[model samples]
Target chain A: MTEVVAREIIYCDICSFPPEYCEFGGTFKRCKDWLQANHLQLFEKLYSDDALAKATSTLSIEKEQQISRDLEKKQAKEEAKMERELQKKLASKIIIKRIERNRRKHVISISGLEVCNIDMKKLAKTFASKFATGASVTKNAEKKEEILVQGDVSDEAKEYIENLLQEKGLDEVKVEQIDDKKKKPKPTAP
Target chain B: MFKKFTKEDIHSRSNIKSSVQRGLKSKFLEQFPKLEPAIDNVIPKKSQVILIKCEDKISLYYVENEVVLFQHFDDLVPSLRTVHKYPDCFPKVQVDRGAIKFVMSGANVMCPGLTSAGAKLPEESLPKDSVVTIYAEGKENALAIGKLTMSTDDIKSINKGIGIELLHYLGDGLWKLVE
Candidate 1:
């Protein structure tokens, strides 16, 4: 019978392989099969075989800390990107400036009732031209009025309307500057 | 323990219903000693009464005869911020500094009356009912009746009539209803 003998083993540095088989760390670390074949390379490089038995135990805690920090940085970057996009979208909605001195003037109420009292058809026509939306008067005797305007109203348009009312000597003209988001436009069917 | 009271067992059932009824009556009396007579008169004879207990609050309402419960649930007034604008629709409410007070048949109701009514719904909008809760206004108790309107916002800004529809006269003390 031949004598049988067992020798000590060595493992790869990066991917955890036996050192005798792995001359360089790069090949084993980059190769998918290399790590699986030489599972103890990285573990052996960091620790002895006795320590390798507890390989996953201490390693996970350090890895978990690293992963949490990386995820936090990624989330912060995404939130900043989203905020920038929202600002851009909101900026595009508004078209604001001082009122033009010579823009043609027309007297129309924000509620659209004052126009109805003067002329229903004429009021509708004027509203269609300027607002390009619609108006409604309550059927009941209370006859509350509401107006819908197309696009976004600029500060200039608002000022013009206020000036027209002031010139007409109306009292306490309270004009609310509606946020573009709150101002809902009518849906076009086609 | 939960007990089943089918139609047949209604009369033969335990005195749970009567016990609840008595408990509610006693609680109501303790809260509003003054409104005992008004409550006794207003509550229908066959009205179903229940006492609901919540965190630091208790409430009693006569369900069967009170149609106002349906209106209160419909108005969504419990979501309202204020009731100042609809003086005609709502009972004549008194404003003190920032708080609002209203009286109905010698009961007090309170509201902050902060919001305006109108443009509340998206389209084909109609006014909704309100759920006003009465609290003490200075020395007076508020009878929190539901307001019949879409929003207090419209009632305030429009200078209109009938902002809130009076639904119920909830007493000031002991009884605070929670949906």
Candidate 2:
């Protein structure tokens, strides 16, 4: 007697494989169409192109281009405003002030030389040797980097800075002095 | 055995010029002729090399994202750990589970640990003093890198004594420095 062995073939609704090897299946186009027809609710829950497009219409290419152009115009306007503000700051003036550190002790601080493009380290070193005082480059409360020299050397510093700027070919560099209100003399008895 | 390294010690080493670095690369390739094709890919022309002086002097060659290669001692041997970064770049030898602790502790690899049951070694012949990565039994990552003390035939025949001299192992100074 001869025995017959039955073989069963299974086709994947997802791909060419028997569903166990779905990852190996390259494309899901046929499976997508089958699901769209056979399982409408499941397909709609899984993927809805029309609904996604409706939800993110503003992010579409045409809308995005329009928004990007508007953003570019706004950025250009802001950049021009910033440039004007910087020019105004450069034109204003340089202020050299003397602040009282303690009784009979004061420190000289120079600010607004940021537009000059001079090296701060070199400038500080020059001021230290020229004025015979310890000088350092530091940032002020306003977040502006400036030079601070020990002892009150505002008058000497102002003249030196003006001469240095002129030597560097910056003709319009202006130096201004600010009086220390905290160090003012007390009123005498009447 | 490994030596401790400070940040300053690593930084003080001079940066090798591109021309000199090329010479070093050629020397390394001469030692391991099998790595000719993959050498360029590991240490590209744009990569930088720094000569670090240590007990076994090391040359650290690296780029921003990847540590390309490091040369040790007068031999200028290429780093097995770095080459192992690229899968199958070098032949691997699997040690028995009993040897995993010893390997991690930076001990010389024993021949029995490699020829024992459940251990594996490449079928191809590997020359003496060749660099090969050591992996623990059933593990995917290489646990240590060593220089083969003797040829593959010697290991197969004798199946005893030290097979490879452990150069860099897990938790060693070189591993920490690379990290």
Candidate 3:
């Protein structure tokens, strides 16, 4: 039997669409810059003045300009939105709180991590395997999701969180570790 | 479908038995006979296939962490990633250049877009509710998958609203669902 040949399409790294269709992806300017950097020949073939003219030559000049104007506004708005999201990510915080279940036992609950760019459930699974304890994600009193690991490994968890934040380029993100103790009367020399 | 899909939409995932895999392969081949030649290369006999059940009864077939196909109800539709690899194996329709922006944004294809100057429809029109891959006027890669709202003849004659119902598109959650 003979093998059938398949087509190899070049997708733009920035927008994840074929380079020819990147103009419609809202991130057009960035996609163009990326294509120019990675594949010079294809970039010239798609974006050169002659090629651009041929692509929209069928449309009336006025209509073409109108569409382009709308696209430009969209691209600007998209760029601004992306910038805002990045700033938000950089400003977020993660708090690892050790809530005292009793005098001898502590439950490590990681809060304020909802803003982080990782999956809480998957992280809980990893923590369960890594710490050899029951690690699960559950909503706290305020209805925010937090990972609860059943053990007193607060220092280890803090170190792990620091390393994780560093790897994600969020070194400025403060992983605050706080210890909580319930109000209880001390046993009087029992 | 998949307009605002996120990881939260996934309910569960499990590996299917080889018998079920064979049944799916045969069903896919029956839908698109042109895919028979490259079926083995696409889905190897020994490879493990995982079925990820998502919200709204949508189930995705994943191989090597990449979603190759999906099923909504009973229609077995190939993903855009799969369309890019074997474009010739599917029935396709090209929309005009002007519609590229709207299609990329996950909008339904209008009849005017299908019958416009730059677009081309098949000589023998396909029936309604048939799944077809969507390509743009000047683009080499297929942008989305859609099901026909009416026959191609009806689209040409009517030249009105919503000719094709878009299922998935370029930068949607399904496209971005890389584990």
lDDT of each: 0.35, 0.66, 0.88
**Candidate 2 lDDT (Cα, whole model)?**
0.66
Poorest 10 consecutive residues by lDDT, candidate 2 chain A: A17-26
Candidate 3 or 1, higher lDDT: 3
Error of 2 at B164 (Å): 1.0
> B1-179 in candidate 1: lDDT tens per residue?
00121112112212228666666555544533433444443343466643222222212233442211121121222111122112122223332312221232222222223222211212222244433343222212233444445454454455355544444432222112212
lDDT of 2 by residue, A46-109 (tens): 4567743443342346754554455456446655776697677558678898888876788988
TM-score of chain B of each: 0.30, 0.82, 0.98
Q: What is candidate 1's CA lDDT for residue B23?
A: 62
RMSD to true structure for each model, in Å: 31.9, 21.4, 2.6
lDDT by residue (A63-162, candidate 3, tens digit) is: 7888888889989999999989878877877888888998898899999886666899999998999999999999989998999999988899888988
- TM-score for all predictions? 0.19, 0.46, 0.94
Q: What lDDT score is found at residue B100 in candidate 2? A: 62
- Tell me, by DockQ, which candidate is best: 3
**Model 1 TM:** 0.19
Sorted by DockQ (best first), the order is 3, 2, 1
Q: What is the per-residue lDDT of model 2 for residues B1-179, given as tens digits with 9 covering 90 to 100?
A: 45354333554456788898889888877766656666666677787766655444555665544345566655544453454455355678888655665676568999998898657888998989888878765445566778899998899899989999987765566655533
For model 2 chain B, the run of ten residues with the poorest summed lDDT: B3-12
